[model samples]
Target: MVTEELYAKDSYIKNFSAKVTKIVPSGVILDRTAFHPRGGGLESDTGALILGGNTYRVTEVKFEGNEIVHVLEKLDGLREGDEVEGRIDWERRYRMMRLHTASHIIASIAFSKYNALITGGNITPEYAKDDFNVENKDLLPKIVEEANEIAKRGIKVKVYFLPREEAMKIPGVVKLAEKMPPELETWRIVEIEGIDIQADGGPHVSNTEEIGSIEVIKVENRGKGKKRLYYTVKP
Candidate 1:
């Protein structure tokens, strides 16, 4: 099934209409959607799926066997073939977009300056953190300062889908593990023009300047010689 990634193509899409195609035990699947699924350190989108003048609040969205399920507070009168409008809570989404973009910059800069590896990460509307293999925790302040300097450049963000064969050609793109699903013909890649690039699946702002002031707040030594850096931006 073709999942329409509204966030990838149009980060600003607030409202859209789709037909209910499948109803499962967990939720209802729409033919197309603007609701973002929970994954890649980003929270699931929350909003409403409207149909026939009735509003059903959307609580979560995810893919189930090629179908996009839009979990609701209550199913109400929603049914297959019914056309519904997918509305995103833009205020929340835009904040995530900004934070997510800031995160990429932080990781990108770290790679360039410290030769560190981002082991893991978590994202929220206002802030996000990335785990890294730092040689010296004391140098974190320098990392933050460097990341902030790059953030100030207000770099532009661009995203694209690459076929597995073509995507493997980029030096920065790392495939950490063997393919779990052979069905995935392509991978989503995020790139900061002239700076960094990674295979990622998340929403981001059009420009790095939109990230505002990224403050690297806390850095913790999480054992095994790995460190976690937490951060937020000042509006």
Candidate 2:
């Protein structure tokens, strides 16, 4: 059976309970989970599982087809059909959440000002890098400044689902230059109030103000038409 992804609807869930549905050499599969699998440029979550007072350190989380695999440091006591309580590392997760939201703000402002589309990127607990299909490197500062300004506005961030056809109609719903959202009947949309909205599947802060100030660490030129902006969030 496919595991229920609780984070899709609520990104703030740090602790949860679920039953072990399957066990393999790689990891254990839970019936429901809040752990976000490593994908879409966002890192996987790390946490611990409690079973009969024994704690299993979850080193990595990933999606194998429809199953959510929780890779643990030791699986000695966990068994299929057993119950477990999982807790994600809040400090790390919160940092990532701030970076993720900051990335969105940067992307949105860049797109509106320069008509740039995101080519690729990575978000981690310490920093975030977003690649754009723009040749002008000088625009980086303006984009960063605008993003920080938006974050200071304290706009609320909203997440919801919409039909694929309807979502595609929005002017800038799909912001990635090379990637299209999965071919699903419905798409998950993240809207940064009146500033920006796009199709995304990662945990984010509830408001832009939670992102604090976004500081540009550096910019890299990755060949022609590709520029990556490296940044970090400061509280």
What is the clash count of model 2? 0
lDDT (tens digit, per residue) of candidate 1 on 5-67: 777666778999888887777778876777888877788788998887799898888767666
TM-scores for the candidates: 0.90, 0.98
Across residues 1-235, which tens digit of lDDT does each residue of candidate 2 receive? 8898888899999999999999989889999999989998999999999998799999999988867899999989778999999899888889999998888888888888889989999988989898998998879878999888889999999999999999999998878896889999999999999998999989989999899889999999998999989999888
lDDT of each: 0.77, 0.90
Q: For model 1, what is the error of residue 160's alpha carbon versus the real structure, in angstroms, after optimal superposition?
A: 1.9
Q: Candidate 2: lDDT of 198? A: 91
Most TM-score-accurate candidate: 2
- What residue runs in model 1 are displaced by over 4 Å at the alpha carbon? 175-183
Root-mean-square deviation of Cα positions for candidate 1 versus the true structure, in angstroms: 2.3
For residue 17, model 2's alpha carbon misses the true position, in angstroms, by 0.6
User: Residue 121: error of model 2 in Å?
Assistant: 0.7
Model 2: clashing residue pairs?
none
